[model samples]
Target: MISRHRKVLREARVVGSERRGTWVYYWVLPPALERLPALLQVPEPAASTSW
Candidate 1:
């Protein structure tokens, strides 16, 4: 018998920066966070509590 573990694969992201009057988000981060800063070069939506 063998036991296995299940891990969820969710690409969670938050707003970072904006440009060209556009709002972008890092919905899917790269292999690491460090890479995100250099990769993501845009702005995210404004934070809101109105779900």
Candidate 2:
């Protein structure tokens, strides 16, 4: 599943998967953390004109 998204993941600076035993873990390098806030940002609501 993840292999299909390699290009996007690489651009996002994700370090790919690590397999230990039966488990797989995905890691993001420090630079990716800086992008998290922008990805999760919420726009402010518009003000109501009616009183």
Candidate 3:
């Protein structure tokens, strides 16, 4: 549940959701977002929205 922890990182904000399909978009806070790739190391869906 990285998405949940993403909140703890204080760097994630729910930007949008795709009701047509199962997907969510998040705005990863800059600095943290930068480090996220290395930290969580998970493949995320392509984000298509901004908070």
Candidate 4:
């Protein structure tokens, strides 16, 4: 799972990470930060639902 996440971040070039001992830390890059709000938004649910 960690490898998968790392691969995505590396491919997107949207994050940076550093390893300290047994743990890894990650942070969003400046370019991605600007888009984070849009990326994190969830669309509204449908106006109608059928049971």
Superior by lDDT: candidate 1 or candidate 2: 2
Q: Over the stretch 1-51, how does candidate 1's per-residue lDDT look in tens digits?
A: 111111122323322223345643223344557666776788788888875
Select the stronger candidate by TM-score from 1 and 2. 2
Q: Which pairs clash (backbone N, Cα, C closer than 3 Å) in model 4?
A: none
Can you give the lDDT of residue 36 in candidate 4? 88
lDDT of each residue in 1-51, candidate 3, tens digit only: 976775554434323223445765555446655676698777788978978
Q: Which candidate is the best by TM-score?
A: 4
Sort by TM-score, top down from the best: 4, 2, 3, 1
How far residue 37's Cα lies from its native spot in candidate 2, in Å, is 1.6
Provide the overall lDDT of each model, using Cα atoms, as 2-decimal numbers: 0.41, 0.76, 0.56, 0.89
TM-score of each: 0.20, 0.53, 0.25, 0.56
lDDT of 1 at 32: 53
User: Model 4 off-target regions past 4 Å?
Assistant: 17-26, 49-51
**Residue 35, candidate 4: alpha-carbon lDDT:** 92
TM-score of 1: 0.20
RMSD, model 4, all Cα superposed?
Answer: 4.0
Off-target runs (Cα >4 Å) in candidate 3 are 1-27, 42-51
Which runs in model 1 stand beyond 4 Å of their true positions? Answer: 1-31, 42-51
